[model samples]
Every structure is written in C-alpha cells, then in structure tokens.
Target: EAMLLSLYDHACFVLGHLEWSEGMRGNHYLACIAGLSVAAAYFPACRWTAQLRRWCAEQLRIEARYQFLPDGGNFEASIAYHRFSAEMLGWATWFLNRTPEGHNILGRDREFWLLLERITTFTEQTTYRSGVAPQIGDNDSGRFVSFLPLADDAESYGTWHADPHPYLSQRNHRETCALLRAVCRNEEHILDALFDDQTQHRQACFYAHTFGVAVLRNAEAEVFLRAGSIGQRGKGGHAHNDQLSITLALDGQEVIADPGTGIYLAQPAMRNRFRSTRMHSTLALDSVEQETWCEGGGEALFWLTSDRAHARIVAATERLIIAEHTAWHLPHRRVVRLEDGTLVIEDFFAAPSEATIWFHLHPHVRADRTGEGVRLEMPQAHAILTASGGATIMLEESLYSHSYGVWTPTRAIAIQPSGTRTQVTIRWQLRS
Candidate 1:
C-alpha cells in the first residue's frame, strides 16, 4: 500500500506540473491534459481532483470543437498528427467514462461521437489500398500509445538508437481501424468495409473538400492528390508546400511517392528541402517554392503566407478524376484516368511559365529515357511517361525517405517546357 501511494503521489505531481505549464492548445498539449485527467481520476479523495477533472473536461471539449475542423480533419494539417490527436482523445474518453462522476462530463455525447466518426471516416477514406497514408506533410510517425507489442528487431524502427518514430512496418491504418472498431461499437459495417481492401477499391474517389484532398482508386491503381491550404489557416504546421502534388501506387506497391519528411530539428536544411515544391510530384515554376517559409520558434515553427491555394474536383467518375488548384499566381489542373492496369495523368497550366513537372519514383523503381518518353520499370509494374508541347523530358537524381531520419537516393522524371508560355500535357501509361 505504501509503495502504491508513493507512485500515485509522483504521478500527481508530474501531471499537475504538465497541466499547469502546458495549456491545452495543440495535439501534445491536449494529450498532456488527458494524461493528467486520467491520473487525477484515480485519486478521488484528493482535494484537487474535482477541479482537475473539470479543467480537463473543458479542454477536451474545446479541442473537439475548434482544433478539429467541421469536416473531421485535424487543423494541424498532418495525417500523423491526426492519428495522435484521435488516440489521445479516445483514451481520455474511455478513462472519463469509467468514472461515475465523469460519465457525462463530455457535455454532448452525440457531438463527441459524431466527431470521432468523422475523424475515423476521414482516415479510412484517405488511406491508400496499400494501407498507408499519403505522407502529405511532416510525418514524424508519431503515436500517442502503443497497445501492440514492439518488434523484436530494434533496427526496424530506424538507424537512430532512440528513434521516436514508429517501426517502419507498422500499419497505422490497420491500427486506427482497430481503435475505431472498439470505440464505435454501432458502426461495425463501416469499419468492416474500411478494413477490407477489396471493398475499399470498389469506391471510386474519396474527396474531402474541407482539407482539399482527393484519393482516386481503381482495382489496380491508386492516386492521392493535395490541392488545399498549407496547413490549417496557412499556419503550415506539419504541412508541405506540395499543392497539386500526387502519389501513385500500382498493385499494392508504391511507384511514385511523396518524398517523405526527414529529420526536423537535427537537419533544418533537409527539412526545408523535403517540404519544398521541387521535391514533390508537382510542377515547380523556376524551382521556386509555392509557399514562402517563415522562421519561428517552438510550436510556431514555419508557416506559409500569401500562398493560400483553393482546389476543387472539377469532375470525377469511376475511371477519371479532374482537379485544379491556383497557387504561385498560376492555375494548374490535373486529370487522372485509370483503365485496367494503366494510369494516365494529364497536367494543364493556365499561363505561360518556365515550369518543371516532377514525378518522384520509388527507390525500387528503375527509370530510363527513351525516344517516346521515360520508361519506369519495377518488379511487377511498368510505366511509360510521355509529354506533349515540346517539353524536354529528363531524369534527375532525387531522394526518397521511407521513414523519418532515413533517406535513399532515387530518380525523378522532370518535364520542362521549351518556352515560357506553353501548354504542356504529360501522360503516364502503366503496362503489365
């Protein structure tokens, strides 16, 4: 009894400092509040327990209402952060429900459940058939808690001895679906369909207007596109300047991927490079980034100003999806068509500009330029990329980061127009 009390006392002290120091603002802040609340729930006789419970309850309510957008997307603009927030909120709800006095502290139970449903559905819809998110922004590969056991091989996490990122093989989508299944008891069918790869591919496109994201999937291919604001309200937290960028997967294998985020604080140059427009699978005008980076301290970090882009799904069908975005004072449109095993992408720029359209290939994919275009060869897939409008097509050295703090040398196909003002159309046809 004495040892248990001592441990409880230590928890109380640490949680009290965390609550008092870091107010509930961001994802991590809310997590701290949740942890403190759970700790306080154990000491019902403590004088501060009631007040702490009320404070934590109010913080959770605020986060559910404001931190998450109406469409169920996290305002931080990072899918990985979304997962973190969802897990923290889920644990907090569960802990509070376990106590008699805290059962109704969530205020409107319906609203809370609706928020959870929206977030989970968004995650399910955004996930690729291969069971991974698009790596849209900064992916530190963070998670709030680990219910599953860690891998026996420590090196699977990363090269760094104490890497905070999750193991490379960890499937966040599968884990998230499991969490949602437990929380959303009544929505078994929705979760079942999400978990089933065959069912997910039956759906044509998942479009979220709130986040300006679109995921088009066919039986054999999937394409993820981003044409929205840089983070929430342009704060650019955990967001990349990758407006109108796309990631492609064929037959459950990544062919073209979003050059994922490298180390954040350890290497600022690499961080900036990874988030730059040139590194994404998009069109870059004279190698200039779509959004200007502002240096800030702490959570403020970096943001983009005067580069708010708006994207809309112009047309979508079972086999075709057309979307457009205006950024860097230019309007760019992308039309994707998937038929059988072939996927074709057509890019249209509104005005004349010296732009380079990049297609960053996966590390395992081999590329070579032929007379017609570039041929990309993989283990079980092949792609032929050809461009019109007299564009100069070439392959350039690039880098691909499969996880945080790790990078591999690769290649990207660059299509540059011969003149400043030209209508360039590039196509990618996949062959068996």
Candidate 2:
C-alpha cells in the first residue's frame, strides 16, 4: 500500500509537470482531468500545502478545456481514451466535492455538467459492436488504469455493437459498457461488474488486425513490432508503415520505433505517409517502408524481456512477443528477449524469404561510427553493436526500461539459422 501511494505520488508529480508543459495545450480536457485525478490520489499522502494548492489551481484552469472540443473526440482520435479521461475527470470532480480542499475546486458544478454531457454523447456514438473501441492511437491506454468503481444502472439506449470488428471483442464490449455506465453515473447499478466480468489483460499486445500490429508493455520499457499482409483492408488509419517491422523496448524505453500517428488530416496523402516504414523501427530498403501499403505485407510478432531459458543458444532474451502471416505462406512467430544485459531475437517462419532483413533504430539514438562497429548512446546507457554476418548490423543501447541494457537490429535477415529449421536468429551480448 505504501508503494502504491508512492507510485501515485510520482504519477501526480509527473502529471503536474506535464500539465504545465507547453505541449499539453491546456485545452486537452481529458488530460487535465487525468492530472486532477492524479492530484486527488496524492491528497492522502501529500504534505506540501503550497504545491497542493498549485495543483488545484491547475485543475481549475483545465475545467473549461473540454468545452473547446465541440465534437467530443480527443485530439488523438481515440474514443476509448476520451471516455476514460472523461470518467477520470468526473471522479476527480466528485472526490474534490467530498473534501474541504475539493469543495473549493468543485465550486463550479455547471462546468462539470457541461463536460459530462458532451463526453457522454460522444462516447455513446463511438460504442461499436464486440465492445471493442476502435483501434486508434493511444487506444489501448485505459485498459491498465484502475478506477474506483462507480454505480451504473442506466439502460444504454443507443449503443452500437460491431460484431467481429477488427480490434474489438466481446470483452472489449464489456469495457465500453462500463464506460457508458460511468458517463451516465446511474449510481444504483455498479459498473464494476463489467470490469469484473473479464479478467484483466496485460499491456503487452495492444492491437493486432489483418494488416497492422501494435503492442506496448505494462512497464513502457519496450515496444514489440510485426506487420503482415493485411494493410490493404482500408485500415491504414490504424496501420503503421511497418511491414514485418518490429520495434524494441529497452529498460522501459523505445530504442527502435514508429513515431506513431502525429496528426489527423482528412487527406489520404497525409495519412498514408504516416503509416510508412520511414516512421517505424524497420530497415529502409531503397528508403521504402511497404511496397505500397498493400502489396506484400507479412505477419510479425515479438516477445519482451529476457526468457533465460532461451538465452543459452542465443544471447538475446525476448521482452516482447509477435507472430504474423504472409501471402501464400504459413504463419511466423517472432520472439524478442532481453537476457544477461543482451538482446536475442529468434524467428520461426514457415516459408523462406529471399528478402534481406534490416533493423532500424530510432533516429533519436546517437550512434558513433568506429571502423566496422557502431557505438550507441541511449537515454540511460550506451552500447557497442556489430553484426556477425556480412549482411547483418547489430547495435546495442542501454535501455532506460529496466536494470539491464537492450540491443536491437539495424540490418539483418530472417534466414535459416545455420542449416536449422528455425528461419532467423540474432543475439546481442555484452563483453565482459
């Protein structure tokens, strides 16, 4: 319990800082409310009155932010996150009302009602079948954040359930319903049932569909990547430019990545460019990401953290897991692990690929060229990376994700491992 409070305190501190960041744009209602919720969490343990008062003032500034977005969607286009933000804000306001400090903050009840009305209308419209919120940016965030259960007995009038939606399932529907209840706040029926109905899912795999796959870690230390032939299904809005492209997480950080969707434009050209490999942690073959976002996408998967059991044969331990499919071919399972301060990668593909594999690091990681080797400088540590084969490139970065370091591929291949059935093998080991 003490540790949890400390974590909450840290989160409140971070949120307070972020709330003050220029990038936050104070107009982000949900984010501000999330900030308020974090602040509320700290009230029990916080002792600095001046800082607490400042936090309350910041929350008050954001009270009117939600009114700016007449449409109710977040700036990021994720309905589920928006709902989660709304619920958090609602609870924050309610909590404040019950406390002496909160009484001062919750003085303006009219603002809460307006924000709730707009948010509820927006949420009800986005609820599709299978209970899965649309697989959009930052869509998977709310799954891990816990909420104090609220009573929700209101009968949903116009909920839309999209059967067999690509990213949503029956369990997803339950969450959506729970959020609906929270928005309506019909206190008689506890909405915790919806959350209780399904065992919580970990944050490793976020969304995997026909064309694109995206995964995140509970620790936010590593990112796993894999893509397949499903990009042509008109889901590029949810797709990354990664084609069999995998991202890695090290020490709770991203060393290789797709920068993720930045902005939304009604134009197709703008959206298509964001989904290209240039933005992902994959090799740029002739500077191309996918052969047309539709041509020959293949399946990919990743495993996070070190699986020591698999580290003897290879120096890498997978922290993320991925499996993907290709055309005229069987499925492939790709395991990414971090072990003994090294990263090892193994691929189990059903077919042979003449294609040379490439690993691209995030452009932000600084690399030094020293003869035939590259030394990388990461946010937390540094590493020297080299390839064993002529066609492979290995680079290591001391990841900020955990206690150890992680190495990623910049150039390599998914080849048959030394005449073995396994198609690909790569390892990142530290020298003593």
Model 1 score (lDDT): 0.69
Candidate 2 stretches with Cα past 4 Å from truth are 1-221, 226-236, 262-270, 282-322, 327-333, 347-358, 370-373, 392-432
Range of the 10 consecutive residues with the lowest summed lDDT in candidate 2? 302-311
Q: How far is candidate 2 from the true structure (C-alpha RMSD, Å)?
A: 18.5
> In candidate 2, residue 112 scores what lDDT?
50
lDDT of 1 by residue, 1-432 (tens): 785577577766766666333223467677776676677667655556667676677777777776677677777777777777777776676566555545667745678778877877777777766556667877877776655543446664433212445464433455565565455554334334334423332257777666667777876778877776665565676788787788888766678888788778777778888988899998887756677775544443455555545666677677777787776567778787776656667777754356888889888788998988888887656777777657888899999876677877889988876654333233344454
| Alpha-carbon TM-score of each model against the true structure | 0.83, 0.38
Worst 10 residues of 1 by lDDT: 193-202
**On residues 45-123, what C-alpha lDDT tens digit does candidate 2 reach at each position?**
4556435544654465364353224444433223334555555555554444454555565455566556556555554
Top candidate when judged by lDDT against the true structure: 1
| Model 2 whole-model lDDT (C-alpha atoms) | 0.40
